[model samples]
Target: MRDILVFLIVFGSIPYILRNPVVGALMWVWISVMSPHTQGWGFATTFPFAYIIAVCTLASLVFTRQPRNLPTAAPVLALLAFTVWMNVTFPFSLYPEYAFPQYTRVMKIMLMTFVVAMVIKSKEDVRRLVWVLVISLGFYGVKGGIFTLRSGGGQRVWGPGATFIGDNNALALALIMVIPLMYYLQQTSTNKWVRRGLTASILLSALAALGSYSRGGLLAIVAMCGFMWLKSRKKLMVGSVLAAVGPALLLFMPQEWASRMDTIDNYQADASAMGRINAWYMAWNLARDRIFGGGFEIYEPATFAAYAPVPNDVHAAHSIYFQVLGEHGFGGLALYLLVGITTWRTAAWIVKNAPKAPGMQWAVEMATMMQTSLMGFAVGGSFLSLTYFDVPYYLMCALVATRVLVQANLPPPAPTMTRPG
Candidate 1:
């Protein structure tokens, strides 16, 4: 029954996707971000919904008169450069067989990311994309919040299976990032019920993040909250809410959760933490030795034996920074960082320059929330190997799209008289 429903929904959307490529893009984002089929039993669980949708979207984009102008924004260009760099390292991959599969997955994500930038022409289109994200990811957030409440925060909160956010830690970070977007929705929503629902979703998502029992996630939430408070216009209200809710959620968790989070400070005694450090060292060493790094899946025991200070300690490069450094090298890491920094600056530029006019407020809000989400990703991703995750890339696409709209709305600067100099 579940499989049938999912199949019908995905297949039924094709007609609409063909007429409007934006629908296909949103459906693709929903499938990729939510992995709704993963929640079902039978054929739907294994179906290649994203690929089918992507092919259709591309065909529609070509057949239709939709403009395919790729934005020349710094972030967009850096992302393209990064994608090209990823492919360049393919031949040099220490484990070609393993690297090939990872390469295919990441390339698909990057492909869709560019598709988003092209299809997103107006503020409404961007809002539709955000709606898909909130509905999809927030499904887990709302469910996890209820689960945490029911379980008394004893068990961990996990995301959809067979996806980037399958683990508790990954889901935690994803939720933390989405909370700010939820707030954006709440603030902009005129309907009282919609605002209330979003308000509840925001609180529930925070609870879901707390219930994940991830030490790195804990740090991430703390860092994100601090940044959100700093960026907010109504500091007193935001601060009051944080002050009231923060301690209550922490106290709601079980002692075991506290014990695990305590290891953040005493990481020397924690085997998992020590292993991550060992992997970081291995990545740094490999990046120094290889021009293009060791390529994908280079965190194998053999590579560790050759490069790791503690060669016997075979572990994944748990940090995003180290993961890219090991898999792609220093150059790849540079490009990756460049994409993030440029995207961030683009958001900042929008917030600073976008007029306070009624029609332009959405762009400002989107840019502000984009920064908040990036804050969560930056801090949470430091200890998580999510270098190839699609959410951050989508956030970059959002910022670029918003920047384009904001630029169009801004007035031209006045001409300066050369004689004055």
Candidate 2:
């Protein structure tokens, strides 16, 4: 029954995806983010639903009337550069079989991101995309939050297996990023009940992050809070809400959680932290030595012997910076960094310029929220090598799409002048 239902939901949308590629994009995002098929005993487990959706959606785009709003700009070009570089580095991969499969998956995500930038034309489309993302990802956050309250944050909150957010740390990072999107939706929503629900969702998602017992999540949350408070239109109200919920959450966690969190201060003494540091150094040293680096699955014991400080510890490149550097060399890392930093600056520019224009107020709100999400990723990702993840790039694509609409339809605000001191 579950399999049948999932099949209907996934396959039923194919026709609509052909009619409107944007809807198809939303469905793809929903499945990728939510992994609804992975929830339980369902035929979706074996069914190639995602591949089918991708094929149908792209085929649909070729036949349907496209909005042609796709920006032929720097972000897209950077993405293409990064994608090409990945393929270039793949032949040098230490484990070609492992690297090729992962390469295909990431390439698909990149292609879909470009598709989204093409199909989504207006602010409302962006809003709806955010809604779908929040609902898909927030479902787990809210559910995990309630479970934390009931379990006292003793048991860790994990994600659906075989997905990007399969581990506690990964799930926590994802939840942290989506919280800002949830807030964006809440701010734009006119329905009072929706506002209330989103408020609860934010608190719940935070709790879920805490429940994951992820040190990186905790750090990211702190950074996120500082920005959230500063970026908010109403600082006082946001502060008050944080003040109310923060203490309660801390008190809810068990002594085990507390002791685990205390390890953050003494990271050098912690085996896991030390292992990550060693991996970072290995990636850095190896990238400096090899022009194309070691490529995927480069963290073997022998590779460590060549470059790692310890020369014995075999560890994954747990930091995003190291992950890209090790996998694709300096050229790939440079391209990746340029894309992210440029997207962030673009978002900031949008936030500054979109407010005065009523038609593009949603862009202002979204760009502001995008900054918070980027903050979470930039901070949390330092401790984890999720360089190939989709969420951040998707946010960047949203910013690109929004910038096109806001820039064309609305004029820039007059620059303010200050008196000489």
Instruction: Please name the candidate that would achieve the greatest TM-score relative to the true structure.
Output: 1
Which pairs of residues have clashing backbones in candidate 1?
Answer: none
Error of 2 at 98 (Å): 2.1
Could you tell me every candidate's TM-score relative to the true structure?
A: 0.97, 0.95
Residue lDDT tens for model 1, 352-404: 87864336878888888879899899999999999988888888877888888
Question: Number of the top candidate by lDDT?
Answer: 1
TM-score of candidate 2 on Cα atoms, chains taken together:
0.95
1-421 per-residue lDDT for model 2 (tens digits): 7778889888789888888888888888888788888885856787888788888888888888776555776777788888889888888888787777887888889888888878877777877888888998899999999999999888999988988898899999999999999998888899999999999999999999999999999999999988999999899999998888888888999999999999999998999999999999999998998888777778789889989999988888888989999989999999999888889888988988887556877788889998999999999999887988888877877888888877787765689999999
- Model 1 worst lDDT run, 10 consecutive residues: 353-362
Model 1 spans with C-alpha error above 4 angstroms: 356-358, 415-421
